[model samples]
Target: MAVRSHSTRVQSFSLSGYHGKPTRGTVTIREFNREQRMRRALEGLGKWWGVALLSVFIPVAHFVLVPSFLLYGMWQLCQRLGTAELATDAHGACPDCGTEQTFELAPRWRAPQPVTCKQCHRGLRLTVPS
Candidate 1:
């Protein structure tokens, strides 16, 4: 595996609830190059394969564990290879409750994803401003 380097940027995003004005927020976006993506995919594969190898000593459990890990590693490899950008962190105020706080975002940074407010516990939608 090659040494991996990722470029990151902070971008402004929008948060909107069912009934309220949208709120502005910032998100940390990590962009992966081809080499970085390959490195990440290989790392995932190696990690899962390592687990699968260890599971071989678990007697009868190896039958299930090994196959599951092998398949999961392939799936992760595809996912990592396809993913070019990831959302690492997000911060914004709840549109409904007007409380400001950090938000837990999904790893894949696609717009119009569903998010929950920490203070109000209400469902909100996150989007990139056009």
Candidate 2:
């Protein structure tokens, strides 16, 4: 009987659709809208006189609710146009330096190749199991 040793090496890995983990900075449309609504409500309460005056013509509730909904709609449009802050995942740390270097992943990228390390400024490559 003869024994043979074989090794396989994968040079590149697909980073396509790499929706890596979402970080705290990532914002969803719903979250954004919620925050905006809260801010508007707080402002209306702070300037109680203005709100009371506005309530004469239109309900104070409508004054705050209408604009917030309009802004939310605008934000949704911008999100569809890829211009708004969305829940986008980011890449992990550098393999070489192990430093906290945050980077946005491209739509498509090949991994496990020599990429310049942001922290060390040296060629670094990360291998993934095939």
Candidate 3:
């Protein structure tokens, strides 16, 4: 009997033609300016507006906006309640093992989902609080 490990697994591929032939082509590497990259990205937006907008704009906007919103919301909340010790994050705790974990905003907005607990290795249902 033999035991196989994932690390030791072999990955093989083949080509139908195995002849002594010269197949060489020039490889060109062209670097684009920031504006060119942006133009190319927007060009992709023409194909799938929703996907391109969501994928490209969301992250860039989030990095520039989420932190600002979170900070301002925290500041206002703290001022209203007159408390300094406070923290806010989109997260849920593992019910089985009581391990807390943060979640992304988009998925958590949809519905409750099962998340694996790092501590007990059990599946726990997590939902964002309204």
TM-score of each: 0.89, 0.26, 0.25
On residues 67-112, what C-alpha lDDT tens digit does candidate 2 reach at each position? 6555555554443343222223334455445555544433222334
* Residue-pair clash count for candidate 1: 0
Our model 2 lands, by Cα RMSD against the true structure, at: 17.6
In candidate 1, stretches whose alpha carbon ends up further than 4 angstroms from where it belongs are 1-4
lDDT score of residue 70 within candidate 1? 94
| Top candidate, metric TM-score | 1
Higher-TM-score candidate of 1 and 3: 1
Clashing pairs in 3: none
- lDDT (tens digit, per residue) of candidate 3 on 79-125: 43332111223344444445455423222122344445466665544
lDDT of 1 by residue, 1-130 (tens): 6654678999999999988899999999999988888889999999999999999999999999999999999998999998899997799999999999999987788898999998889999998899
lDDT minimum window of 10 residues, candidate 1: 1-10
Predicted candidate 3: what Cα RMSD to the true structure?
Answer: 24.2
Q: Residue-pair clashes per candidate, as listed? A: 0, 0, 0
